[model samples]
Target: MGRGRGGEREREERKRREEEEREEEEEERREKEERREKEERREREKRERERRGGETGGEEEKRKREREKRRRDRRRGGEEEEREREEERRRDRRRDRRKREEEERQEERRKREREYKRRGERGEREEEREK
Candidate 1:
């Protein structure tokens, strides 16, 4: 209704708009910082992967050679891998058999010791009876 009242309302609206603008600017600054941090992380990860790949080149070449050798063997219908596997199994079985034999021998020795102790106890009792 009055010029002074209208002026006062205008000043309040301007202040509210200025506060909203400040908040929007702050939000934009935060978003920019987040984007920069994400980009840095991605770059670091990419560099790390490149370094690892370079380090693994020798291992990759070794694996490639092994694969090629296996392919060649397959083409020739060679049983080299199977023969090696069987040999390993045979060695394992021989080792297991030896272990079992050793255990049995130790068990027999323990049995003999127990039997001798029993005989000695009985002989002592018989002597006491004779006394």
Candidate 2:
């Protein structure tokens, strides 16, 4: 009974705030729906493009490009493998040369030992005859 005009003003202000809130909610819902629709449309378009590509032998073209790249890579790999084989051959040659040199050195040492043994036997024989 006492609050007449003040109550009316308060009611009007509350109603305005609620209406603004409802509008914001509606805008957010619309934005979400629009984003979903856009995403669906993009997916549909991508599928259609893929189907068209299949029909036009675009997949074959892609495969051809891939094959060409693999062929190039294999060619390069073959060159690298040849280089590696050449290096291995060089290493083997060096190893064989070292082995031959070592054998020659050992033979020289055996010859020297034989000569020294012969000289020692000759000296012993001479000493025994003197005794």
Candidate 3:
């Protein structure tokens, strides 16, 4: 029983040491990840600066202004196109309304003609019967 106790104590000590080692390894991994992230951030910033002409100067300012102008022009062009489309739609609607009204008038005239012909036929039949 004494030997068993000693064995149990040794196993517990070993487990503790293993846990500490794992924690240290995890801390090291976190440190490395942080370092890598910082390096990557610096690189991205440097690239951005280079893309923006490496300095905030008159040239960069000019480019920014030109970009803004182009954006505004595009927006204006889009608005003009939308207005033209709306006008076309309005014209189409007016034309369609006129066409429908014309069709309705023609239909009414046809109905009146048909009614008149029917009455004339009935009158002729009555006259023949009287004769």
Best by TM-score: 3
Which candidate model has the greater lDDT, 1 or 3?
A: 3
Candidate 3 per-residue lDDT over residues 44-114, each given as its tens digit:
85786577675567876778767976886897698668757755765675576568658757976997899
Give the least accurate 10-residue stretch of model 1, judged by summed lDDT: 75-84
Q: Which candidate model has the greater TM-score, 1 or 3?
A: 3
Per-residue error for 13 in candidate 1, Å, reads 99
Off by over 4 Å in 1: 1-72, 75-78
Pull out the clashing pairs in model 1.
none
User: Between which residue pairs do clashes occur in model 2?
Assistant: none
TM-score of each: 0.42, 0.45, 0.48
Q: Weakest 10 consecutive residues, lDDT, candidate 3?
A: 19-28
lDDT of 2 by residue, 8-123 (tens): 86588568657656865765686578669768966985786587576766668678757866885887688568757755765675576568658757976897899899999999
lDDT of each: 0.71, 0.72, 0.73
Sum up the clashes in candidate 3. 0
- Of candidate 2, the 10-residue stretch with the lowest lDDT total is 19-28
Candidates' RMSD to native:
37.4, 40.3, 35.6
lDDT of 1 by residue, 1-131 (tens): 66797578659856865765686576568657866976896698578667766775687766875796588568535445654665576567557656865875797699789989999999999999999
Assess candidate 1 and give its TM-score to the true structure: 0.42
